[model samples]
Target: MVKITNKEAICIAVLFLLGSNIVIGSGMDVQNDNWIAGIFGFAYFVPFAFMYARIQALHGGKDLPEIANHLFGRVFGFIITAVYTWYSLHVGALVLRNFGEFVKITTLTETPLLVIMLSFSVIIIAAARLGIEVMGRLSTYALPLVVLILVFMEAMSVSQMNFDFVKPVFVHGFQKIARAGFSAFTFPFGESVIFLGILYSLKKRESAYRIYMTGMVISGIILVTLTLMNIFILGPVEGDFYFPSHSSFSRIRLGDFLQRMEGTISVSYAITCFIKASVCLFVACKGIASVFGLSDYRFITIQTGLIMTYLAFILYKNTVEMENWVINVYKYYAIPFQIVIPLLIWIRAEFKNRKGKRPKKSEELEINGGEQEEAGNEF
Candidate 1:
């Protein structure tokens, strides 16, 4: 197995969470209430950051299932793994479907949804097969380009920005803005909880927390800044339109030479979505492998990819329905597995540590602590 450095782990985690779907989805809410949403996003990270640090501290090198079984019994461990696996696949499908719809509406109006799904799924499978190191390296290369494009887009729109749009921002009352902020925090920031699986592969524990916190802060800043820019350039009335970033890009006209820069934003979004999907796919496969006692993870990627594709098709009948589902269902359904399960694991770990307990002797003998060891053997 390839050991990941703390910096590499952080980069992958950041890119995985700050991808196109998150930025676009969260950016929409921020446009409505920039300051409030931004603060909410920042606040959402507090609990997650603590849980993540505690998990790593308790079991830095172990996978989720192992950690679960270490703290809970074998049955509970398998249940937790199953829940996380389901969440990963469901989220992956949601992202894939969302991106496909965005492309159909904005760029590839004539392309078949199946073709779009297949193309993206094939790329994700290939990336997972190559292993997590390649994903990290790929993100390292792609992230800077994405950031540069965003910076340019923001800079070009500066001249047209009307600070008056954000004036008297609280005129809508703090409660409405606060609600929007909570929605923003839960989706993009809280979603970072998924990174715990991959992050344990990091070599340096100290750097893990620093990179995670830094990435969270940076992502929050970018999101809030983009929200403010969208509101300033497009005005609140126009900003409320679907895909405000796309709309903002469409309005860019630099001396008639640099017009219709929406494609730039589209390209960046597509790349980010690709990386995010790949990361989710990897984690799902890894979780399943851990649960099923598999030695080779690549074997499950294609099967899981097919399952994800089907799930994507079933997730939403149409774009509007998908957006509604995301706003309503995702928050409640995802939080228990994503945030609550991990919190439980952390608490269990702390309790065990305080009482000075370890796994039974038979459990340690069965797996010998090998990375690929199964929970049944360990328990």
Candidate 2:
């Protein structure tokens, strides 16, 4: 089996968290307070990382599906695995849809969504078939460049920023900020739970906690900083734009000659989205393979990618419906897989560990009797 170091795992996590986030900034409804909401959401996700780490620790090197199978019967375990597989597949489809929409609106106004999706699907399938180690290494190499470009864009935009626009904070009260926080937590932060599949490939299983936490912290900083940059540059109008980061970056004028820096955001977005979708696709393919006892996951990667592309087109009638579903339903809909099931499994694993540590009644009695005999002999 291929093994990934903690560093590679961290890179994967960072890019995965950035996947849709760079394209769709969180807490759009909360306006200027979106960055604050993101911070709170980051805090909310810390325990989840710990929980996922605990689950990893309990099982050593085993993935979530394997842990379920060991704790539950094969049938139930396979069912749980199937559920997670579907979740990954669904998420992959959503990301693809987001990509298609972004490309349609911004870059290729003339192209059909289906053709764009097909081109992306072919690329995604090819990447997924290359396997996890390749994906991890690609993230390791690509993330630094993408992040650097993003930072440069933010720096360039700083000259045009007006921090005054972010003034009069909390004017809308904490309720809206709290709601945005919840949205941030469920959509992106909680989505990290999908990393459970890739965690199995880590070379140092004991370092999973550190890897998860580090990745979250780094990505959280980037996300919050980007949001703040958007607020500063775009002011109250940030929320008005669908892709504020791109809009903000486009406003960056470098020396009057180099103006359109939106391409920086696009590059980072594409790279991050590729990493995120690839991870989801990899997990889905890998999980399905585990369920069916297949020796290789690549066997199904293309088929799954094609299905995901189709699902992307048909998932919503239009972008408005898609946005509505995301705002109204997605947060609640993702709970079971993200928090509920993992928490249950973690609880069960802890209970089993505690039970295993305790001596049986018969063993306790034998120990007492042996202690009494030892005392008599000493006397």
Candidate 3:
């Protein structure tokens, strides 16, 4: 069904991982040393990423819902799939609200948050309607623009960096760094759990290990670099800005010729965020279809997108509340869905594989010298 090459899958993963982190910046609790926290966060998430990849390889073309139903039994699997579907929707809404808040506070000061969110929701719903294949192909193009934008932002602001801000390693002690690293793992890194919804569409199931591992490593580096760049560009007063990456980008100016670069960078953030929202919505739709025994997920894309828009509106009263929730509440709220349940699934998959339940090579046909194609799905 819905086939995508390993390259497309990895691109989507990188962009999805970069998503909101580009706008809000990650590991913020540690302030200037957030990069250190991000590095450790990536380290902490490495094993789990491999485990997730293994789950994909073991299950082959089976998406998470199917795997759950087969491994956990129908009733329990239905419950687990429902919970994960809800988590996907909830995370998508949180991200939609984040971008809405960013736009409202920054460039579109007068634009209604509802309008901004609805606009983005329409785009996301359209992309979801196009299905996973289209989404995967789209990432092949969009990710490069995002990468270029990040490079430009870093280069343009290179002169503004202050070496002094990086002094006194772990100035706030290891506790805060660990806390921030935990937050980083949960929010961005651990959230890769949602990939189970569609990564099954990957052309060659064996590529899951390479896809997940490579994407996470690249995204982790980008995230850590952005965090460190913020510290360097803003120096000791980096804490003064809520969106440090955006603030740092705003400082770039090549004598009025290249002024206001954050505008371009802001567009890049929106592109990546849009990809994240689209993937989340698409996954939620697939999960719903699987749970309810529907043939296709097309019918519910609009409904789910609108629902996400409304939930985003009611998610937080303002940016302040949202920021507080992300920094303090979201970490704990996201842990069970992203880590606990996924761990359960991984354990079961491993047990099944050991019990000779692994899918045979015949289940998937990889031919044409790796230029693979999967069975088509009209859905």
State the C-alpha lDDT per candidate: 0.75, 0.86, 0.86
By lDDT, the better pick of 1 and 2 is 2
Candidate 2 local lDDT, residue 253: 88
lDDT of 2 at 293: 96
Pick the TM-score winner. 2
Clashing pairs for predicted structure model 1, backbone only? none
Clashes of each: 0, 0, 0
Cα deviation at 335, candidate 2, in Å, is: 1.5
Listed per candidate, the RMSD to the true structure in angstroms reads 8.2, 1.7, 9.1
The total of clashing pairs for model 3 equals: 0
lDDT of 1 by residue, 6-26 (tens): 556666766766675433556
Give candidate 1 misplaced runs (Cα > 4 Å): 21-23, 27-31, 357-379
lDDT of 2 by residue, 81-124 (tens): 99999999999998998888888888999999999989988878
Worst 10 residues of 3 by lDDT: 369-378
Cα lDDT for residue 122, model 3?
94
